[model samples]
Target: MTSTRRRGLIDIEIDAQKEKVRKIKEDNRIFDTLETDKTTLDNEKKKWFFTRWFSPTSIDDLEKRIARKEQKIKEGLERTSIDKIHELEERIRILELAKTNRCENVVWMDVPEILDKKIQDDYLEKFRKLPQKIDEQVQSVNITMFGGVGVGKSSFLNTVVTALINNPQRIYRDYKTAPSTTGISKTKAFIPEEIRKKRGQSYREHPTFKDVMHCIVFVIPATTNLYDRDDEALNKIRNLQQRINGPRDVKQVAIVTNIDRIGVPNVDMESVFKYPNVKEFCEDVSKVLEIEIQSVYPIANYHEEQKPTAAKNALALMALWDMFKCGERHIKKKLEIGLNDDQ
Candidate 1:
């Protein structure tokens, strides 16, 4: 071979040897780094396992601790569930009792006979003389007329006043509007003639009965069920009863108005009166008011009276008058009792 070719061959062989050596060194360095990282990871894992699984005094102790915690959680849940169940049961009991009371039916004259005969005789005498006693006086009663809006409450009041002032000879005054924004007006009117002719001059206009409302007439709309506004109506009635001055003022009556709108398939007023809702409403009102409802009168008011054959509206007015008269008699009896007690 020529000298130049031999020299080039020698240089290529040396370069190839040097490249192989460099690649071997690089590979060794990468393996060393990987080994170190693997060792570190293994050590950390072992340490964590030792601390978590082996650090306890014994396996049995660890097991006991776990079981106790589980038991505590279970017991807590059970206690909470039991407490909730008890609360629910108590609530249900109250509701059931209220329901039972609401379903009960009683007659007005069947009120418990607890009075002495002398007291009864005195009451009867006063009751008989009530008309003469109240003659020529303005007797005012404070009434809390309750029902939903559009329940013929205003219509009932108008009917009552109209009935009171039906005679052309008497001058009747319209009551001032109630201050409610909902256009519900509860007013106190002086049925001057009824008061004057029925009660005596000594009985003056008194404030809304401080004790019991002399009369409570629930004016229900005929078209709806008694459960209509049941919760709301019951709440208001309860509140009013609470506001009554004393037990004596707790006179109550139920007037189911709007029979004309009821529009039965084939029923008369007498048949309609047998409706479960009507009976239920009457009973509920009496229970809530804490008084025996003096009566339940069904009333229907259309433009023309002939449309409702039952004279329901007129009868309702008569019911109101009867309630007022009964309440007045009660008041006089109470007053007499007070006088006797004072003596």
Candidate 2:
């Protein structure tokens, strides 16, 4: 009957939607684990069957067991539609917008507050609790970059780091580029299989894969032409994204860089949308990468100087916010927190 009652009802619906999204995320995660395990089991069975065809006393038995496991995984996957997860996400966004009395894409002005230590500490604590090392995948928020070497991945990453720490030089601390003096051989005697990579390292690099990174940044130039090796590298990243977060769910932002060089350098750096060519490039890159166009951003990083500009700083904040939002959704899904949970 009252406004308070209406607000309370909306909050209740929001909580319900959050729970639904969380559950669906867990179901899809289980499905991913099943797929990974089945693949590995299949490979092991094949290796034994092929290598020890005459020596095996139980080759057929192993094959039968793997087939049974694969069937179970397939059934589990079929029971849960991936579309449900997308629906839940949209519903949650709508619900949150209604409750907050805000429009979609409400650019919060509290960047300094968000950069505060308390919020980050709280996030890191919860992120640590997210289930890790699921078969071959790390449960951290991943950002996969797909582009050439000179595409300004380092510069863009530096800008992001500068904004996060409120210090401009943070990006330079660990930033070192490894160059190949002798160019990569396309026609080598043996082109080794491209080794799989993820957010965290194995036992050699890290003791554990928990809360190591709140974000994973993958850099790729926007100039990667279609059907080229750079394009092929982009596909490798696409596959990695699918492998880590499944076909339907991955928090990815394609940082389409070199807008400064693509067209005449706009002295007005914030005028990214002002140029029709820039907008077209953004669309084209997203289409090629098979990601949402909204996830594609045009950025120009500090090449000659380390100082931040108002326009460039705004873009950096935006990119970081996008990445953080991805991390937040991922943390919620992976942790499976309830309304009463401390997170």
Among all candidates shown, the one with the greatest TM-score: 2
Residue-by-residue lDDT tens digits, candidate 2, 213-277: 33344555646564465565666666556654542344667776766665524234533454556
TM-score of 2: 0.45
Clashes of each: 12, 6
Alpha carbon lDDT of residue 167, candidate 2? 46
Error of 2 at 184 (Å): 32
For every candidate in turn, the CA RMSD to the true structure comes to 33.5, 29.5
The C-alpha stretches of model 2 lying farther than 4 A from their native spots are 1-147, 165-218, 227-230, 245-248, 264-266, 337-343
lDDT digits (tens) for residues 62-166 of candidate 1 = 445445545544665222244554554554444333333322233333222222233333433433344423322324344545665667666666554443334
lDDT, candidates in the order shown: 0.46, 0.52
**Model 1: residues with Cα > 4 Å off, grouped in runs:** 1-144, 162-213, 222-230, 245-248, 260-267, 270-277, 287-290, 303-310, 339-343
The window of 10 residues in a row where model 2 has the poorest summed lDDT is 183-192
Sum up the clashes in candidate 2.
Answer: 6
The candidate that wins on lDDT is 2
